[model samples]
Target: MDETTTAGPAPATTVGPAPVGPAPAGTAPVGPAPAGTAVAAESGGWLELLADDCSPGDIQRLRAALLAGADDATRRRVESEAQLAETIRARLADRGRDARELRVRDDLVRRLASLRDSAGLLQEVVAQSRFLLGVDVAYIMLPTADGGRLRIDIVDGSLGDTLQGVVLRDGEGLGGEVMRSGRPLWSESYLDDGRLRRVRSVDSIAVSEHLGGILGVPLRFGRSTLGVLLAADRRPRRFSDHEVELLAGLAAHAAVALRNAQLFEENQRAVADLRQSNEALKRTDELRRRAGELREQLTAEVLRGGGIPEVGRAVARAVGLPVQVLGADGARLDAGPGTDDIDVVAVTGSAPERWLSGQEPASRTAIGRDHLAVVPIRMRDGCAGCLVAVSDVRIGDETVRLLEIGAMTAALVVATERSVAEAELRTRGAFVTALLAGDGDDAELRRRAVAADIDIDAIGVVVVLDNAGQDERAVAAAATRIAAELHGWVAQHADRFVVLARQHDVASVRARIAALGDGDLPAAGGIAPAAGGVAAVRTAHEAARQTAAVLLALKLPGAVATAAEVGPYRSLFSHAGRDDIAAFVEAALGPVLAYDRARGRDLATTLEAFLGQSQHHARTCEQLCIHPNTLYQRLERIGELLGTGWREPGRTLQLQLALHLRGLAQTLAPDVGRRGNTP
Candidate 1:
């Protein structure tokens, strides 16, 4: 039969020559059979089968015909031509498919732009994707908050309801694989595919939906996979690369939509929060202004000499709290009205002194139903006191700050009062000094003393402190304390504090001075016997000066010696460096001194104490706090050193005179007789 009359469709004209005309009926075929006649005939039949869209059985029959009697060149030529035809067909098919895809993409873009909300846009997108992809089911599986799995959030197409809320674990099945790999994945027969991890929940859902194949594409934004977009078929199907790319494009649009929706919602909440914060700030500013006015009013009251009482009342009225002012000595200076329930004493006693020392104001919870806020009143000296504000209602920070300002005002008042009192004391002290120094007339001195609230005519002892090594201000402070105790006059005499106290109160004055003790200095004081009138003041002062001199010259610290205590030493020290006194001290203490030097003993000190006690062994031992036997032994040693004539009547008189002179000489001149040699 002719080529046109063949049973199958005809092959392309470019493939080869048509079938030979029956080999010219008898003789040879035409002209060497056209290079490859037999192979061309076989190849032509195969091409015919390709053009007919034949079933596999028809294509198999055509394969047998092409192979029969075909040389290697024919086989190669057939393969090359077949590949060329396939390429041409694929290019033509792509051109047609691209036109269709362009149309679908335009429709998707138009639908997405027209939809006002993310939910509508996403639903429409999945619906269009399912229709375009020709799948049984199409859905979006977006990541949950924790990003460990994906849940179906949008669905469309046949059997879509079954996957409405289906969740896929990470790395499980096709959808999980796409999300984890951030790429597209497809399975022709999902249940039979061993490449993907199988999950019971995913498998059960697929079985129920009659799904045999699936294609999944990761929904990506930048480098992050937002979720997976999936297309599935009921019958087994091999998904095309083109179909995966289309779904991935749709997923990218969906990610942008979701992110936009989230941003719009977040901005809306931020605007609402900002408005609320603005309203609260306005309220706070108003409170601050009101607090400022309260502080101004309290300050005005203080400036008008309202004192601590007025301050307390102002604070109580402004803050609606009970207020109390405590002095440095813990005395309650003022308490506001209705402060009966507030325990001023307990609060002041319990106030933290450390806080006051550090100058840090603090508030604390108090007993009963009250709250206590303490603001310390500080001055140049130290903490003057604290203002304690008590309230049944809780006090806010602004109110506490206002109370601190009030405390500062009270401290100013206290500091001013102290300054005035100190100035007055200085003036009185100057007048008393002039009177004691005998610089002015006696009558004039007495008159000035009376003017300064001092009684010069009263009988009183004159006490003098010498070489106290204290600054004038410290001395003044100590003198002020002592004068307050004695109700007497205290003056700065040279470098000493001189006091003229009442005769009956002299013992109390001495006790007070002794109690004052030696603070940061070695103070020596001397008290004269009580005498009357301004004429006797000079004599008593001279006696006090002499006694103080003796105390200092002897290196005796904190010693308050009187006229009676010094006895003969007063007369001996008065005539310092006299020949008769030196000779007598040499005769009496010479042997004891020599023995002490040779033996490295304190025999001279023992002998002096023994003789000072008038040879009373028990009193001397008691004074020394030593055993009587020890004293007796020392005395025996002294007698041995002195040839046993030291305790006789005439000898004792000489010895007593010498001991008195030696003590006086040492006090007068410290270097005399210091080398174990008599002066």
Candidate 2:
């Protein structure tokens, strides 16, 4: 068995004293040893020479001189002590080397425990491996993906990349054998080792690296082998069993480190994934919470009978973007807080057809410098309108859902409004129609009119709309809206619109309605003089109808001809009004003449009866033996036939003078003018 343990075999201890040559020059001068001084070898110079530290040559020379004179027994004892001293010196040297090797191995183990990842751990293992075993180079080979071969994973103290990514197959080299057997294998001279089946590529690499000796051990964990850990030298050398054991121990540590590194990486990845999932859950929860709150808010709006404006405001507050609502016709019905800053007209024009008819599903469409997101306001009939959100940036999918909820509520509100509006129009339209037909009792009719938001006491007179032959339904809708704004009511009667306006002046009421919403209003209308009572309202309706016919006959479309603006001389008027005395008569009597031609009854007679009696209705009714309503209707017809200017004081004088001239011309006979009698 080997007594000394270090990386290599220790020098063997010599059994005898070293041969003593001529005295070294530094030795103390020695007289030729006094031959006759025969000191005992056992006690005399030997003990003193041993006690005092002296050169081996001086000590040996002294023993030789003394022993020459002493017995042979003394000489033998001196040789025995010298041999023991030489053995002790060899053992001391080996003890120092062992101490150093142990320190290096301990440091490698400490560093291996500190590694954190597989790649870094493998690199540190190979580097420390070279130092611990005192080899020229070190490397580690891990099994390839298929485990059919081992590829060099890491290398330390290498001169080039010749062996990098190099593979060792089974039965190909010493590294391959270690991988197959899962055991330690080494050789004193790698090139000469017939035990290893060398491959051409590995052999060339080995020669290029100047490698002669090699040692490798399998990195084993439990029962399975991971790879090979190898150390090599550039010159031939014998690797002792102790060196082999040390390398195997390191390989064991490397295997454990590799496994630990893999587990550590997996744990880190798991933690990162968990953190990301947690953040996503938090975001999802936040969005759900916001959606719930907005839904409740919008539901409250619908339940409370809130309309589009209210719904728009609630959604705007939630989404921080402008919102607007439009009717099925794309008219602006209501706008929210931020809508004033947006181009409402542009938004309406660019809107998708789905807003009205829901032809397609909702999505985002880009408008100039803005984006529009719409949700159809679905109704029982079809899509009634749309709820729109305008933003400079794109709206997210979550916010789109919130807007959809708002649109749903808006649909309910709009549907309710439409139902109520239709019912109201029916009730009010019937009431106004009956009152104009002179059918209901005055007191009962007045009460019913009040219920329909019409103060019958405040109604002055009625105006009949010709509607310019436009759509009667559309015309009635516009007329009803105007009546509501004017605090009155509208009636649809036989393709003509009769509105009982509450205002005092017919011209003011006409202008007011034109301002209200006239896009669908008639271009022509006729007004009667201010009157009250159901009987008087009936006469007013006839007068308005006659004036509207006169306007139509005169080709005065878009003109509101009223009974208070014309004179009796309109029966003598002409086709065109120009700057002549004849033109003045033409402008004054044109509508009255047209009325007589169309109605086949002369309003010229009614004009003469009212204006000829100095605007006094009772005297005219007495002279004609007609009712007071008949006298009032004739005077009002004069105003309606001659449109606009004839009701003025100066205009009335011109009309009166014109009527007087026509009377004189009628009284004088054509024979009197032919006989040259100037009358």
Candidate 3:
């Protein structure tokens, strides 16, 4: 029998001999070899095979079989199971590592992706953090403005029901201690830890049975600590190194997210502020444009054919008011924006003092109980009149401001119109006066006089005076006083206008006033005979204006002029070319002016009085309230400097003109030191 042939019972022919067996498909065949040689050669393969399943102990058994002449099919079958087992073990190890990595990566990715909704970013960060570490409770607490409190922004699970939106104060509890130090804390047991304190003061701090192994890491951005991230276990659980690292990463991400959100909010606020400012600027521009248009329209209307009364009526209608146009005194009723058909509307009486006196920013009277607005009709010169309106509702501030501005424009138009009308009246009156004086036809003269409101039979007269720089109160008072005095004189004579003073042309007023009543009226008090009629008025006005101008030019360390006076330079008034007048002023006043420059004295006072007194010692002394001796001494000095006798006729006239010019300069001057240096 061939040993190579497979048999039920094999016969041992040698100490180590080959045995026969059927081979499995796709396996190498095994054969007999020398005992030691075969064992040695096959032991390496068997050891490598045993590494798949049974390990080194199985290698011994395979080596023994090889020495006992094991067949090729048996060894090959053994090798297959060992190799198959080894491949399966390697695959299983790789799968486990991949699964662990996938879980960690998926968690990180999900947490990062959840930051889209800013409202819930903190909540998601806390809730998802449970998977990566040993944490029974996780919360994000943001620092509040007040140092004592920390605002719980988000918490995990049912923690919201127990601790949602909680505030913890510093040094009050475990969380408090963490915030106070601005550092991470770790404790095996929160209640048991000696460094941790239990909060008892507030009823809101929820007391759990035992929160162990608590950890609090500060959430910070640069030097600014935003809040803290807290994690705790119910049963004490130590955190691994990797878990701590994960928490730090979470804290970093949280800080960045919060900062980014804040920056975004600030950007939005800046945009809103810019838009608001732009809108305000646009509204202001529109208001300015509207004001310009309104001014243009009102000016055009006044320049057109409308008289003051007509313009007043139109303005009153536009602004919804009852309008009155008064003369400069506010007493002389000039016109009313009222229709005669409207019987219920009463016109302003000749005297307006009763209605408009003692009022500030003008006056207001309620129409029934609902509405009122009173605005002074202010002119560039002064307030000539006022516009008063009443409505059935309360007026707002903006509306009042607008009404005032509109009223001011209307007042300016009225003033301009008045000036034009007055000038026309004056020209017409002068023409009529010349005709009557020239032996014109009696009927024509009387007819023209009546039409022009002139009194040819009473003798023509004009009285002009300084208007006090358009000081409305002073002008009105002076005008009233002057009118009363003239009326007294006229009443004694007849119902003749002894002094008919209009508000225009002060230059000729004194002459006109002087021509009245066959020179029978008493003398004007303290006014020189040379300065009668329109000349007197012109002289007084020129004196005042000049005094104001002088004070302004000299910077004469003083307050405003309360009073000013001018007297005639008789000889200069009689004769002297225009060029001679300028030269005379330069020579006479030049020495005094030089003295003033050097000494800073108000020499203007003495110079003005000396010229007005015609260089007479008694007159100069009386006017200056000094003794004649003192007046003479001053004059002697002046004459010595001027190189002439103080009483010389030609010199007197030159000195007077110089004094008048100096006074004129003062009139144009600004009133300095009016407001004392109080501030």
Candidate 4:
């Protein structure tokens, strides 16, 4: 057991981790004594010729000259030295046994010393072999992430374009098999091997065997082979026993160098981990110190409510941010942290999407110069609004977390402020509405309207905006900006509802929708329209909504949309409750439902398709991909059961309305239920 442990080897550890950062590269072979002293080893015939003078300087110069050859010996640099140098001339003849071992031993020592001295010693070994071994080409392939494949790390210049970084998996190429078996392999002629034919990168079998003699040794640290080291001579260079020994020695040295690099990297990682832990601890202490002060500021802001722009400002300050409050949809509510010296950046449509879709941690960006955090402000579990935090530096985790907490507290503050502002606006909007309705004094209403940011006498249109999704911040922001723009228009007449929509009920306003012409507004897409608003508001909103829906329905590849373009459904404006439509459909579709229950067929999908097809036999058949006979039969059965034929426009409309209502019910009812369930 002891002998095996020392000589036979204990099982190998995993291929050490990849070296961190850059490593020295090239290859040379040497043997190591028990004390780890590297001694030069003899090379086959070449080493004897090179070591003729048997001087260390001579050997060094020879090694350098050989290593100097172009990766492919396409040039005669190494060959030139071999020809002119006495050592090179000596290689033209055979040398004595004592001289060969001495030469081999010296080469081994230098190779081992290089490995021990450099970070990328393995790479160096491959480079040295190309110089010293008179090989036409060479490469060092390493195992990939899975260790199931070999990847070429370095290749000769001639093969650079073709084989550099090429991957050869186990059982693949001549090199791959050697890598898999942890054995030295040689192909005196590569073209003859059936296995080499399998190498994918080698397009031609002739090309694979072009090397006169190809030699490979598995690179192993212990029992596991990292990959294979390959050397190829384009001309028939005899593979001497000493040459094999030298290559094996280099392979061993390369493995050890790789292991050392991996250990150095591991030590570095340990230090980095310790550093991060210490940094995290420091941040925790900072957070703790600021927590108390932040909590007080937040409490005070909450008490003031959202109407006060100062409250948003206060929250930003508490979290050390220069934030602008926004609605859930991403609207700039009231620019907090003052806009005087502000620099605007890119704006995405919705605040929620922006916040949630962060690819990187939010904290880092939140503190960047002119960085803004658009935080949604929630009240009583509902998102009442949003706020932005602008800072001079990139935000850290501590900053983001603190801001999140502060926003929650600020929500109540901002909401309270909004309530107060809305009360005043509502008083004015009410008078204006009454005047428009002919129930109030017009002059007084007009005067009040102007105060509420509305010009009752203006010929301009009113607009009421609401976000369709949870991201009200952007929508609310667009509303505010549009309102400001409408107010700025010189139509010489006032548009009612120029004030924020917060004061008015979204469903009660009614008017014809007039969409803005392309020239009338900036091309911001995805705005929702409010059809249920006061005259101009409803008109403008409906136009916007219709535009949005049409755009959405069109499905243009890259067309953008805005809330103002997406109009409310006609049903939303109707006095009739949607539940009535549902009741009607439930009553009419009983037979179809019954049939579905009996047969387990998806009757609902079929009915939906049938109705949408407008009773066109060809279209319906194509859509359903059924025979005309089958479609007709189903339609007939449906008509008999539902008391409506495909041609009955009125009944068809009713069924269509039913389907739409049911879908709406499924989606909208859940929120209603959840709200009702809440205390």
Candidate 5:
């Protein structure tokens, strides 16, 4: 309340506590007792005065006399009794206050739910603040448009009219301070308080109103303070801690209720405007009848758990035109019955979204003596899709409006479906994550799998996908899609995306995963055969992740393979000596040698020439004294026989090094190079 204007000099005010004043007239031991009065009270003479229900003054005098003459033990007993009595009184008072506060909060919640508009809610909050505290005035200060000042929005109590619509400038009053600090502040004799900065215009109003005691609490909604809820008194009175608490609680409730009511009003206004526009556009009886029928059918479909298919049919029937529902990605979700004749070429080629650039809710394009219109299906998440309508002639505004109604219905159904799908996905993801992490005992794992409707025993393959510079959301999306397709679940244990699939063929599973990208793996993956219980699953998950890392380390970014496929090379990086190197080279070269021996082919010589010639077909051909065509055919045959993985740079490097070892062995030891297939 900014009422600081005063015409004359203000009355002197006591700032903190009640001022000391002359004592009230009373019988202060008018007649003096005998000299032994203080001493005689020790034996029980003073106690008899209490049996007569003595006056307050007489009891005070008697009590003082006993305490003055009492020994140390007696004084201690008296003090303890006084302390216990004070504690009891405080506790009882607290109980009453707590009960009152609970009742007020409950009432506020109920009132908020019942409030239909912002003004009514604000008015109720202010009134409750004043009545609950029995203060002289209560009001809320809301920030102005420019936010440089606050205006008194609503007030209650007889003194409130003086404050309504008063503008409080920045740094002028306690209201602004409370708002800025987001904490409650109170002052006795606010007009005379020296600690607070005062503006002449606001202070003058305070003086004129004779406002004294004031308390302000920030009206907070979420992290922001919308305004200040303040209570002021006409007398220089000190507000208690309990009173401050009560006002603050009310302010919190008011903030939430005000915001809710604001949103509600905005929605109501929008709906009303839409309804009015619809009525104005209602031109003929037949059209009105059809629109009404469409509304009912669409509403019933949504209410009865319908989806795009149901919604599409109703709109098509009402408009006597074909309708198609497209998903967010422009994929066909569903088409109405007899919608085979829809202009697929026109609709697919045209961007329906571009047509929505103007003020119209929907737009259309000509289709060779026919028309196709689309209304965007806006759901809570975003634009979920569009409703495409085809007509024998140009589309009309009324038909477009009907399509919008259908779009709205379709959005609701799609949103509900999406929500359910998302919830299921979360449940599945969590289950798979727990399963992979071995979070629970065997029984618990089985129970979780059963609840998620998953068959634990059907699982045969575990694959881990590498993020490896992929968008996290995109990686997750791919994992979820593949997991669903495979009748399994995806879990992200740290950065690796693990998919537990039902298929047992690791190679076939890798093939499916490869299709997710263009012709290679969507992500570098490690595939392992899954079996056993928690321990086996955990071991396989670790192995799969290890394999994926090895693939990445080998510079095979878009490849999926098992750990054993690269185990020999992996050993080359570990604690392996000459024997290990010899064994690896033989292992790497033996396949080609054996195939050549069996088929009488030159695959081994071709691979040796290719590697020795730095994989140049012309150079290898010239070195081998063969034609380029022959070199190519031999290289292809070598690739098939050895499965060399020559395209991978790391694999090629390993083969090159192994070829060097073979050459050295031929020079140093005559029989070493002939161990697999002799010349």
Candidate 6:
């Protein structure tokens, strides 16, 4: 180092060979020595190897040369070149791999973005996975509700149709194993694979579809495995680890999409159900509100003292339907204008018998396309009537309930009205009784009668009803009808109904009484003469009672004996001292009366007829409808019964008066002659 360091610069040019040197006798000649030549040759080979295309083996050879004998410069050059080549190759490979991965990710993103809904999302996921994974078929198998099986949901690829809608139990197929384990699974040859339990149906489908290699990855959301995403190939081949990884990645994306779709569908169904429930509630509330309104209207009408017609109209307006009120006898009570054609009888008749029984109200749709709702108008005693409503369309349950409420209200109103009417009638009856009894002065009676709505100025008759063995209620009801017909007033008197009517109404009152017929013991009635003022009313009442008593005694059952019709008999009977009258009748007509009684003959009748004809034989015969000889013989018999001189003027006058008196006695008290006494 010391000697070299002191030297100046060495020549850069190469020296040419000089003179040939001779070799020593025993020593080898040192002409261009082989060791230096060999070193130069190795260095050149390394340089060429590094400069040209070379393999790992060539680079290794170059490295060996450097380690063996190459200079520092050659070694450094070879090391640098080798590192550069290695780096270039590695970078190129990485770039290519990255590009392929980027394409797959971009395709997946594009497909996911294209989906507008869950169904489309599922289909695209399966299709994209199938295409990217390069499998024969791809499908998604979602777990069933029970979590014991998987149903093929979306399928794609060449043989996708063959596997569509296939189902597999939890441990049945490759896909089922993946779902059960919540992990990925693969089978190169599924038919021969024993690791996964085989199902004949699933295997048959696989066989039919010519599927061999299969790879399944669990589709997971949160901690739960929702299903399996599967890829299958037609030919038997082992699935590369990279391929399985790629499929699992696709399956992960698919799981998220499928879960989102399921949630979306569930949300949509829930929203629809909620909407329907809201509508139903709204309708129910509306019906309740309407029914409440109707009930209020009906109650208001009833409280206002509305009658049947007014109530019917109010109900019709409230419910928008036609209404009918029927009496207990099934008669139409509301006979207002325009109601005659309503066929109320038909409505009532069509009502269910149970309603009439006063149990619960009922409603039905009638044959005439009308909805009929009927409710029994029940009172404390019984069902007094029924309220019916008819509508063009069927009503709701709420509306029917309202109708029932209205019926109850109407019934209460009717009962109240009846009670008021009865009270008024009682008051009127008491007034009439006091007046007939002559309990007050004429002026006081007249004033009281006016206040009672009795027409003192009008000529009125008194009618005495004999309601023997008949229901007092029926008699009272009948009297009411008579009063209505005669436009008069009726009052209860003892066990009879006494009616007061004007002279013109007397005949009508009598006719009405006749129409009522005899009740129980052959009902008898008597009419007093029409007269004005309260005094006359008292007299007429007495006269009517006497007449009724007379008719009853005479065995004239169901007879209406009037004062004017009975004539002189009423006048004579009114002079009662009935005992004296009976004595006089016995004295004058005793012999004839005795003869008639003993033989049950017409001796008394013949004597009266002979006197009635004024002693003319032919007229007497014609009056008695007998032959002259028969009349003569009957007259001789009467003379014998009456004793001699009975046909003389003085005797005939006494005998005629006695005959009239006898008839009067018979009418006044039919049992008088039998008892030989007066009543």
C-alpha lDDT (0 to 100) for residue 183 of candidate 1: 82
Error of 1 at 427 (Å): 1.0
C-alpha RMSD of each candidate structure in angstroms: 17.0, 21.0, 21.6, 20.9, 28.4, 24.0
Better of 4 and 6 by TM-score: 4
Model 2 lDDT per residue over 1-679, tens place: 2111211233321111223233334443245533322342445544454344333433445656544665668667755654443344335445655676667667877887788878888988888777766778899998898979889979998889887888989767999999888889998899999999889888899899999789999999899898899999898977777778878988898898787777888999999999999987987798788878887998887788777898889988887778877766565668566677766457546445544555555666666777778777777766777777888787777677778777888887877886787687678767766776565699988888778876766668677777545765556656666666667667766557777777777777767755654432454667775567667777776667656545554456557767655433233232232124455555667678678889896776666666678777778788788898876676578677776777677877877765554553343223122221111
lDDT per residue, candidate 4, 18-74, as tens digits?
A: 111111224222322211111222231344534443422233334443454357652
Candidate models: Cα lDDT each? 0.68, 0.69, 0.51, 0.53, 0.70, 0.68
* 287-329: candidate 3 lDDT, tens digit per residue: 5665566556566766785555655565555545454444433
What TM-score would you give candidate 6 relative to the actual structure? Answer: 0.41
Output the TM-score of candidate 3: 0.37
Name every residue pair that clashes in candidate 6.
none
The ten-residue window of minimal lDDT in model 6 covers 12-21
lDDT of 1 by residue, 1-679 (tens): 6322432232221111122211122222222332233443555844454454432324323333454688999767655654454444334444555666778777777666555565676688778777777777788888877888888888886454677777878887788888888888888988889999988877887888888888888767778787788888888988666667777777777677656665666777799999889977886796677667777886688678677788778877766677777765455677567666667646545645545656444555455566678778888877877777776676677677777767877887777766765676666667856765566887788788877777877747887766645545545555555566567777765566777776555566566678765332246777786677776876776677667767776677558877666655555434353556777777777878888888899888888788788889999999889999999899999889888667788987877767766766766553232222122
Give the alpha carbon lDDT tens digit for every residue of 1-679 in model 6: 4322212122211111111111122432223323432453465543444334333333433444444566888767756755554444334434545566568767787677555487688788777776666677888888778977789978886454667778889878888788788888898888999888888888888888888888889988889897888888888968766667777777777777777777777888899999989987897798678767766776777777677777666666666666677766465666544445566436445544456764444454454565677767778877777767766677766666666766777787788777876886787777777776667788887787777777765747788766453766555655666676566787876556787876555566566667655432245678886677777877787677666766665567568867666665554454456657777888988887788889899788878887898878888888889998888788788767777888799988988888777775665554332222222
The local lDDT score (0 to 100) that residue 565 gets in candidate 5 is 77
Candidate 1 — which residues are off by over 4 angstroms? 1-306, 309-313, 326-351, 359-372, 380-382, 390-394, 450-679
- Superposed by TM-score, candidate 6 places the C-alpha of residue 449 at a distance from the truth, in angstroms, of 20
| Global local distance difference test of model 5 | 0.70
How well does model 4 score by local distance difference test? 0.53
Deviation from native of the Cα of residue 153 in model 2, angstroms = 3.5
Predict model 2's lDDT versus the native: 0.69
Clash pairs of candidate 1?
Answer: none
TM-score of each: 0.43, 0.41, 0.37, 0.45, 0.39, 0.41
Residue pairs with colliding backbones in model 5 are 3-205, 3-206, 4-202, 4-203, 4-204, 4-205, 4-206, 5-204, 5-205, 5-208
For model 6, the superposed segments whose C-alpha errors exceed 4 Å read: 1-116, 146-148, 157-164, 266-289, 305-679
